[model samples]
Target: MPEHSDLGLLVLPEAVCLAEALCDLDWRRYVAMVELNFDLTQFYDHVAHRLGQPRMFARSIAWNRDGDPLRRWVMAHCGRHKQTRNQYWDRVRRHQLPLVHSGR
Candidate 1:
């Protein structure tokens, strides 16, 4: 099987919640570490619900000569900063926060 990118693993609803929790624990200090952080349970719940809808996760091509809409949706609408996963995890490890249970 092809390996999935960290963003491929995390851009969905369930994983985004954990990202939010990390941010909340640090009071926005780690905002640069993640692309998006959502603290509101209601909003997150809405996202989870929407993702469950039929055809919601379907892949399609971008028209209208625009750039990557998926990136815009994930970064802009989701309020995430654009950073590589390595940079994110490195910062998290350097912080030495107790929230992470699996980091080296």
Candidate 2:
């Protein structure tokens, strides 16, 4: 969530959330990812710096246009990721305060 504002940026790549997989999968494949600091103060800072509360998680594309996804399954997983993200958004809408925005 953005600090002192309701507006927040949800930057999904191909419209998918990327946090839940933070600890589950190896991120070697996702070269196009913009991750902020992986600490406490930095976490609050990321949220505070935003224009408003982050109602949804977003991923700024860290991959270059030339970065190739080696497998078709990778692309397919991204699609599923998008669907999962939309569900997350719906859950957030049901609440008031923002949840912890998981880190890199």
Q: CA lDDT of each candidate?
A: 0.43, 0.38
Candidate 2: clashing pairs of residues: 1-53, 1-54, 2-52, 2-53, 11-59, 32-62, 32-63, 33-62
What does candidate 2's lDDT look like per residue over 9-99, in tens digits? 8676422222333222445223222122222223223332343434232122122234333223334455556655566656667686766
Best by lDDT: 1
Candidate 2: TM-score? Answer: 0.27
What does the lDDT come to for candidate 2? 0.38
Report the C-alpha displacement of residue 97, candidate 2, in angstroms: 7.1
lDDT of 1 by residue, 1-104 (tens): 65876555336674665455434534233434443334323333433444553322223211212544432444453344444555766787789967657777
